[model samples]
Target: MPTQSDSTPTESARLLGRTRPAVRIAGYSAVLRTRALLTLAVLIAILCTLFALDISTGEFHIPLGRVLDVLGGGGSRAQRFVIFDSRLPRALTAVIVGAALGLAGAITQSILHNPLASPDILGITSGASCGAVLILAGTGGATTGIAATLGIPLAALAGGLLTAVAIYLLAWGRTTTGDHGVMGFRLVLIGIGVNAALLSVVSWLLTRATLTDAAHAQLWLTGSLDRSDWSTLVPAGIGLGITLLIAAASSRTLAALRFGTDTTRVLGVRIQTQQALLLGAGVIAAALATAAAGPVGFVGLAAPQIARRLLRTPGEPIVASTLIGAIAVVGADLVSRTILPVDLPVGVVTAAVGGPFMLYLLVRANRKATL
Candidate 1:
């Protein structure tokens, strides 16, 4: 019995109400999909740029065309040797170390639900540093030599694994859920203690060593890509690839863990098992990277944070982190080599850049907490 105009207004309102939710949902879906696609494209482009930069920018500059020819197996002997022999191993090593650190950071951050968590947070870097220092102090020669190469990497792995196990054990307390229960705060506290103790040991050893050994140890501690050879590259590449695959596969479980351990358990994720696996993977990744380069700092801490921001995702994106990490290290290495007249240590450069960013993050987090 209502007038036609009145009925028309009511119908229009109903149509808007029905369509609004649909439009909003469609818009959200489109945004998410677009973000994912953009992340992928950025990753691909960055990788290509890294490869080009690695081959083209060095003391003996190779033209882009010749670099491509070398890559394609159609270059002169000199070009092939420079590209394949000299640069390829170091470039590949950078990628392996960078990806490993990035993935490790992503896993640690997700599991801890703390953006500050990284391989260093668990004392892995400190452990590796201790091992390398010991080898340099104890072994009476260049720590980067063929003999020390085998010993150093093994020692680093052993040190990292031992430190991780110790932290896990010390943090574990009896709980109804399981025998090994970790209190996050307690774990972090213990890791700090371990890191401090290991650093003290390294300092003592450095003082006792000869001047030559001390200098070599200092360079290793600062971190460098100067000595990466086929020997270091092959093992690092194999380990990095394996760990990256595992991290990617665990992304779903990691996402569930952001809620809480109990929620992850409710979702049928093996919380304890996954935690152990991820921690172990993170330690191994960090260890291999340390051995390949030398405690290359901040890649593990900064790469994941940057990746999350770039992707604009709420939770950690492991794949995106890996890509961003690769870009970060390669880019940093390029800067270290080209920006400075003399070669700068990669670790020094990362620390210089990441140190400020870390302080800013800490301040922001503190302000938010106070508010």
Candidate 2:
């Protein structure tokens, strides 16, 4: 209805190969809502603040200004030692491990088309936990040495990959409608069975192990961070870097799969192969995170769902989910360390939060179905 030279804002932006009016720079542009961008910025700032508090607020209680000085390479020898050798590793490990779980959750939920789907549902976390428990029982509470740092993580990785493969095989089938695909429902059910069996095995091992070993195994099962160090941080960081690259590269294919198998196939993706590839990347991320943090329950489930709602994304929001996960885990750690008289595991806090949220989501999903 407009006359010549009166193009709409959207049209003008499109013609300029841009979407957002505020973020134009040298022929490049991006589309993002102002409120959403502000929300993201706030989240980032909060995360930074939390990360600082995590390193500074302990028995020693370094000030925030001093914490920044330490970070910028200006603290005393004692401050540097505490920040570099003790607190920094734990905080970084928590952030990276949470990022891994969030990315894995995003992948699994997208492919399965279920908000509840996660590494736990796929049996990866359970498998990793089982493997770690086995190691603890075998070593008789020897979690102080190099064996704990390397051996447990390697075992967890192996267990996660094996569980994923088993789930895929068990769920593979041609539907009665003559369509061949992996059934998500079947996979989840089979994974539940596997998890139960593995948990029983863990219990048996703990019963046979020394009391000290049993205690250690129980603490690990609770997902405590009593043992986080540079060793845990390094591997988690490496895995996250790899995951980010793979997820970015395969995002389009993953996006297509979210629309269902027919759509992915129509987009020229080999359904089985692409699924395997995507699932493997997710498994790697989940496994590495579990290896680092000992099955921090519910972060994987909560982070992506929270991110999707906060960002209002049609598909899974990978970056937002990762940030949300970091916030959840770090914040949980803070609460565990400060709020309670006794130290509770971060996993326990997350479970307490996520369990109710999950029930609410289910109720909502049911109500929507009724409507």
Candidate 3:
């Protein structure tokens, strides 16, 4: 090896140039990470503000200070009762449900390579709704005692899982041979068919149900947090927590999967296996959230795309999407209670926003295809 002093100017500059790109790339990576962290912090702050507003604003409005004090264990009993007993559960439910939907949407869109993909469109939400509706119809809409607390959610979870299994099985065989895993196009088409069939089942159930039962079922189907309590919240929250951990563990694979199946397989990923695992996690998240809030619409479908745009990321940013989802639901719930003449279900507000967003996505995709 030659001594450093013996090297010519050209050799030194060539060596210097070789190292510069790596240094520059590292700097860019650091900047991107910082930007992502800052985005997450801002989203979290917004989510907290929305949560407080939601908790404080209701039929008997509680001030924000009192709300914070009560949360910190320093308020009057009435304030505590109102915050902890009544408003807190509903608001907390919105946060948890929103986070879950965001995770589901992010993962689904990433794995499928489709911006338009979401739990709602893939029949997962419909399955959960069907399960809950079936229970309501069977009980003549009088879900009281244990039924109210445990029955509906359990049914919804079962329904969602069953639907996911069906979609996975139906689409798995249709995937083209190669390193590629489940084909996104096939899954979407199959999911649409399943979704249509499930909707028909729901409609038939609604029609055959008694008038009172139909009314109750319809309300639940619209997705309301009015029924949220400690009983309903605890189990769903636990499930979501577990699912979140699993999702975080699998985040690296999801990111790789977004690069396309061939690339993912080249990275030594078991494409189909990983896809199924991630899809299962996403499905569970959506189901549990739906169980808690009765199929709150479009949060899953919209949150990831919104978060991706906000962060200016190439693909959906999972953590940011989760935070945005929580914010959207909390904000929507607050709007439903305060801005509207009558309290509408939070799902109504989400659908109003998501419908147009979906159409825009469809039109954008078509334009891309035509071009």
Highest lDDT among the candidates is held by which one? 3
Please list the residue runs of candidate 3 whose C-alpha ends up more than 4 Å from where it truly belongs after superposition: 1-32, 144-146, 174-181
Better of 2 and 3 by lDDT: 3
Q: Under the 3 Å rule for N, CA and C atoms, how many clashes does model 1 have?
A: 0
Candidate 2 wrong stretches, greater than 4 Å: 1-36, 143-146
For every candidate in turn, the CA RMSD to the true structure comes to: 5.6, 3.7, 4.8
What's the lDDT for candidate 3?
A: 0.86
- lDDT order, best first, reads 3, 2, 1
- How many Å off is the CA of 244 in candidate 3? 0.8
Candidate 1 minimal-lDDT segment of 10 residues: 22-31
- lDDT (0-100) at residue 35 of candidate 2? 63
**Predicted candidate 1 versus true structure: per-residue lDDT over 1-371, tens digit per residue:** 76756657678888766652222464443223566777779797988787688878887899988888889989889888888888988888888888889888888888877777787766888898787678867764354556555777787888889988998899788644564577566777888788888888888889999988887788778878887788887666766877877777786777887776667778998877888898888888888788788888888888888888887888778888888777777887888888877789888888888899888878988999999
Candidate lDDT scores, in order, read 0.80, 0.83, 0.86
Writing each residue's lDDT as its tens digit, candidate 3 over 278-312 gives 88888888887888888788898899999999889
What TM-score would each prediction reach against the true structure? 0.87, 0.90, 0.89
Ten contiguous residues minimizing lDDT sum, candidate 2: 140-149
